[model samples]
Target: MYKILEKEDIAPGEKLYVLDAPDIARKAKPGQFVIIIIDEKGERIPLTIADFNREKGTITIIVQEVGKSTMQLGNIKKGEGILNVVGPLGIPTHIEKYGTVVCVGGGVGIACIYPIARGMKEAGNRVISILGARTKDFIFWEDKIKTVSDEFYITTDDGSSGKKGFVSDQLKDIIDNKEKIDLVMTIGPAIMMKVVSETTRPFNIKTVVSLNSIMVDGTGMCGSCRVEVDGKTKFACVDGPDFDAHKVNFNLLNDRQKVYLKEEKEAHKKCRLEERISGNK
Candidate 1:
């Protein structure tokens, strides 16, 4: 059992958990993820590795309370143990001195993009970061991301914070200004990533996106996380959670994400009802 070392409610529906997983932490890299099970009967869910402390043997995961499993995970306190924590999974982001790199994050994807931006800066790349959320309340890690970025911008759908626009808009501005962008890495909702990819495609900017497909197992055997990249099938679990944004079929990826929507809502509803009953008792 992997023990929870700490828990913090970072945003309205987002919780960050630091777990004691020495092996995984030792091997963890930016752009990889973990499959966690809250309990024996719990379903496996993949969460990107948000941060890691190698010396402390801990890995941090930021989760938004969007489904039954994540809600259950939020109820778990520090010192409690998780049934399973399988990871350091997926290919790590290719880090190099790729000149000026733009890292874009939307909503919870901000958490996923943090470490990668830091890594890029460390590799001597000029990191420009753009963070976005629906509102100010959903945003987190502004200071953390800023520390690594040479330049940073924030946007919100509502004018609650930063500019009243999307991350794609900010990116477009940077592109239009003729900034020399060597590579662009984005992690966010599929729609947001799609827009960012489209924004860069015309200029032929090297763009990468992290795909959050429907993944069952952390291995390729399950075939649940297969995505079409460059018109070829690739499994997100083993092949990558990262791929060339231009070559990815965003339509298929977005459609596949909806496969469990109805069942997910039902599960969340049942879990909520059970929690209320338990609270009453």
Candidate 2:
């Protein structure tokens, strides 16, 4: 059993869990994720490795309570043990000095991109980060990201914090200002990433994105995480959670993401029902 060493509420409905996984933490790298099961009967959920400390033997995973599996995970507080925690999985980010690189993250995708941005900066790249959310309360890890970034821009639809626009808007501004951006890495909603790809296409800026958000059953045996990249089928679990944004088929990816929405809602309802019953008892 993997024990939870600490838990912090980073944002509403989002919790960061630091787990005691010596082996996994030692081997973990930027852009890899883990498959965790709260209990024996629980379904496996893939969570990106937000951060890891090899010396402390701990790995940090930020969980957003979006569905049954995650909500169940939220209830498992610090000191509790998880039934399974199976990785340092997926391909690590291709980190190298790529001149000025823009790292974009939308909402919870910020957690996934944090480590990547840090690694890029450490590798001698000038990292410019853009973080966006619906409102100010939704944003987290500003200080951490800022520490690794040469320049940082924040955006929100409501203008509650930072600039009042989307991350794509910020990207356009950066490009329009004649900034020499060699590469762009983005992780967020498919729609957001698609927009980012479109924004950079004309400028010929290389963009990398993570498809972990749409993935299910990280073992690749399920084929549920299969996505079309450059008109060819690729599994996110084994092939990559990271891919060139321009070559990715965003239309098919968006469609595949909706495949389980109805079922997911039903599952969340069942979880709520069980919770209420247990509370009453």
Candidate 3:
């Protein structure tokens, strides 16, 4: 069992957990993830390693309560023990001095991209970051991201923050201005990553994106997080949570993600009903 050292509600329906995971923290890297089991009967869920402090022996994960399991995880507070926290799983990002690298993130995906951008900067690259959310209130960690980014831009779909468009729009402006981006990395909803991939493909910029497919086991034994890249089958758990965006089959991934929609809705409903019933006591 891993103790939750601290918990904070970073945004609506989103929470950040600082866990006492010394082993994982020591080995954790940017672009890797951890599979968490809230309790004995809990479902295993994969979450990106948002940040890690070797000295503190803690790893931070940002979770958005989008499903039943996630909602349950969100209810866990500081000092509670997470039943199982397994990993620093998957390959870490390939960091190199790629001159100028642009890191793009959207919604809760910003948490996934934060460490990658920091890694890029630390590797002697000028990191330009772009983050977006549905509205101003949905965004978090802008200051933290900017501290590591050479240039940072934020956007909102409703013009509630930095810009009145998508992160792609800001990216296009940078590309059009001939900023000479050597590499582009993005993490977000599949659709958003697909758009970023498409945007950079024209310029033949090497683009890497993290795939959030349905995952059961973190060890790739379940085969639930399968995805197609470059016309071949790849598992997101063991093979990657990150892949060449230009090569991934986003349409299939997007469709595959919806396979559990009905079940998820039902489960979420059940959780809500249980919450209300428990509250009434």
Q: What do the candidate models score in CA lDDT, each in turn?
A: 0.96, 0.92, 0.93
lDDT of 3 by residue, 128-227 (tens): 9999999998899999999999999999999989999999999999999989999999999999999999999999999999999999987879888999
Stretches of candidate 3 above 4 Å error? Answer: none
User: Could you give candidate 1's per-residue lDDT for residues 171-259 as a string of tens digits?
Assistant: 99999999999999999999999999999999999999999999998899989999999999999999899999999999999999999
The prediction achieving the highest lDDT against the true structure is 1
Can you write out model 2's per-residue Cα lDDT over 79-195, one digit (the tens) per residue?
989999999999999999889999999999999999999999999999999999999998999999999999999999999999999999999999999999999999988999999
lDDT of prediction 3: 0.93
Model 1 ranges with Cα > 4 A deviation: none
> How many residue pairs clash (N, CA or C atoms closer than 3 angstroms) in each of the candidate models, in the order given?
0, 0, 0
Estimate TM-scores for all models: 0.98, 0.97, 0.98
Residue 233 local lDDT, model 3: 97
Candidate 2 at residue 119, lDDT? 97
- TM-score, candidate 2, is 0.97
Q: Please, what's the RMSD in Å of model 1?
A: 1.1
